[model samples]
Target: MILADIPIPDLELEAHDGIDVPHDLVALSEPLEPGQMLLLRTLDGVHRCAEVVGLDFTENETIYRLTYGAPMAPEIAAAVARPPRSALRHWVDDIDVEVLLGELADAARRTATTSQAAAPESSW
Candidate 1:
């Protein structure tokens, strides 16, 4: 199975609805899978536990596409990035944990390789 140990930074979520949870949602240091619950924090100071509806990853970070209730608002759907994907909680028993782990491992490897390749030559 793919393995990763990325350090996660604590981030706060902005309140989208009045029922938002209070406090910053720390992105777990563990890997994550779709359909798991996540403590989502916004740029403001709102927090909520949302299920992973979808995911989009880039070289720098992963963007989560989340949903709350039926008849979702367009504004909430548009601004979904906050703590970044590196901080998501991955449930070990999650059905797709294997695949998610693989993808995360691959992404982490690619990032490491890219960074190493771009680094200046070292001198003893």
Candidate 2:
């Protein structure tokens, strides 16, 4: 989920370079049923967010309908195709890339610790 969609009160995002942008929730339900994708355009770049209604990942890359709104501008699309920091102001909100990355790393560490604790210790 993009930070823009996060239900934080008055939550505004700041880009890695310190820029703000606007966003809206665009969902594809009918033609794109059994799944939904969210597109966010921020000052940094465009982001693709999706949720599949059914759990199935036996394929190389899970195939789900691309149901989301994205920038149509060639330049914007090109930027979005590159990195989150390359998207412009549209569906995504600008956020601090370093901060977000740090948060993700911390979460990963916590998850790893939790998994290790839950695993049975075996001494050979």
Q: What is the C-alpha lDDT of each candidate?
A: 0.43, 0.39
Question: Which segments of candidate 1 are over 4 A away from where they belong?
Answer: 1-26, 41-47, 69-124
Writing each residue's lDDT as its tens digit, candidate 2 over 1-124 gives 2222322222233212112211222222222335433334444444433333442233443333222332234333333334455456444444555555566666667667878999998998
Model 2 scores a TM of 0.31
**RMSD to the hidden true structure, all candidates:** 16.9, 16.4
Model 2 ranges with Cα > 4 A deviation: 1-36, 39-95
Ten consecutive residues with minimal summed lDDT in candidate 1? 1-10
TM-score of 1: 0.29
